[model samples]
Target: MTQSRRYWIPSVAFCAVLVTGGLAAWAETVYVQAKTAQLRSGKTSLDAVVGNVKYGDALDVIGRDGSWVEVKTAAGAKGWIFSNKTSSTKPSGTNDTLARLGHSMRGGDASATTASAGARGLDKASEGYADRTGVSARDRDAVDRMTAYQIADQEVEEFLREGGLGEYAK
Candidate 1:
């Protein structure tokens, strides 16, 4: 009975170690967050490019060196990528409001024109009414002159220095 108990204890201990090691070996998963991420052969940007990953591509993190992470792709390619280029979650689509608006306009969304006009503080109905009522050329000329006005660089610098703005702050 003593011999049996000793063997059982060692077997249980070995099994626990195996399980713990296995869990540790399971690589952490991350996704490429940049529009284009280059996986390099070394931790530094000067290293040879080993692979290219687009936004949302999955990578299994194997290790890290400073700001770089070693990873393996689903295709079994292994390389290093900047830690900043990868995220634990997949990247969402473009965050640019202008890009989204452009897409909406290109897609022919019925409300896009109205939304764009509203953004400029103008309504389509009011614009059409004004057009029908004849907008003053004087007002248009004033706007054009205002847009064409430019300040000399030296004068702008002087204004900034006087106002203690940004790098000009005392």
Candidate 2:
């Protein structure tokens, strides 16, 4: 090959790589769906925590293996995160609230982990329903009790393992 042609070939190859990398980034960009997610060093959450991601945090898709996704954080931390903790689309106002609620329900501090209910939880529709409906104080108390119930992480892990759930089936 001619000397000039050899240089041109490498330049073309470099450009191709750059283009492919850019496309891959946009194709599967995922946002953290959990209020706080630990990015592990391996496919399972049992691995060492390499980093942490919070709700709505954008993560560049590096690769995927079953229910685990390899990601690079904006701060350049690379690790594997469970697919259940991420979403293909960015979180919106409603999604953000849901994610926070999920975190709070999972035993996180109610006031710290989630946005105030008065802001996101209470809206015109909910207020209207409450005003029109004749939900008794006793029934409301029962509902509150049920919603306050929190499951331990160990129980969840055991359930997943015993049931062969998620990546465990593989």
Candidate 3:
């Protein structure tokens, strides 16, 4: 009975160590949240870059060192990336309000009030303020051009692909 007890204790201890080690080595999936992220050989920014990932890219998080996370890309490349650049959840889509508004406006079903407001350029209060501030038409045109510019989804996808970002890298 004494011999059996000794063997049982060692077996239980061995099993506990195995379980603990397995848990420590467990990996979690994380998605890239930045426009571009560099996978470095070390935890610091000064470390050599091993690879690059784009927004919405997925990685297997294997370990962590301070603010840096060790990750493995889908291609099986291992490196460290900043923890702030990754998210547990995948990005839903673009959050650009102006882009959404532009799509709605170009859909040809905008309300009369919207069309009127756009065509009139500025409300009376705004026009008065602009005149008082000496704002020029050139400045307004430049603003309009900047606001009117919209990045197409295809273009963004191509850019991501070219940069080996996100799903493209997968």
Candidate 4:
């Protein structure tokens, strides 16, 4: 029994090391779960965008920095994408309507609202959601062309700083 116990302990330790080593050598893969994930040059939203990965796109994870993930795109683009935008498993419904919305979030009559969505305020309805639960789909989508708001990181930082949200908030 003593001899068997000694062999068992060593065997278990060896197996543990082997398993951990094998897992470490294996590269982790993730799929983009967001409508559109911007691959940034760095691990921050303020970083320059290197590429865009669509929903359900597979990404090879190379490393991780905080909430950011370093990945290599199928097209050979190496960049950082937010960890929250990716999924451990391949996403379903890749061919679904919502998945086919394309890169632009704004759709339908997008050219209608035009310049009315800016500092002047939104005087128009844009790309209304289609809910068949209560309202008719046709009635749900009132008008389109809602101006997309693309606020820069700098602007947000300035606002937070002005409000004295705290130190190193950015």
Model 1: lDDT of residue 62 = 88
lDDT of each: 0.74, 0.76, 0.78, 0.71
RMSD of each: 11.8, 9.0, 10.5, 11.2
Candidate 2 per-residue lDDT over residues 10-106, each given as its tens digit: 9999999999998875666899997677789999756888987888999989999988999999899999998998998888856577787887688
Report the Cα lDDT for residue 57, model 3: 92
Q: How do the predictions measure up, each by TM-score?
A: 0.47, 0.51, 0.49, 0.45
lDDT of 3 by residue, 1-170 (tens): 99999999999999999999987567588999988888999987557889989999989988888788999999999999988889999887695778788878778533232233464345455555667998898885565456557897668857977886653353
Can you write out model 4's per-residue Cα lDDT over 10-87, one digit (the tens) per residue?
999999999999985787999998767679899876688899888899898999988889999888899998888899
- For candidate 1, lDDT tens digit of each residue in 96-120? 7787888777784433233544333
Whichever of 1 and 4 has more lDDT, that candidate is: 1
Worst 10 residues of 3 by lDDT: 108-117
* Model 3 lDDT at residue 2: 100
Worst 10 residues of 4 by lDDT: 123-132
For this target, which candidate reaches the highest TM-score against the unseen true structure?
A: 2
Model 1, which residues run further than 4 Å from truth? 1-26, 94-170
> What lDDT does candidate 3 reach at residue 38?
84
Query: What TM-score quantifies how close candidate 4 is to the native fold?
Result: 0.45
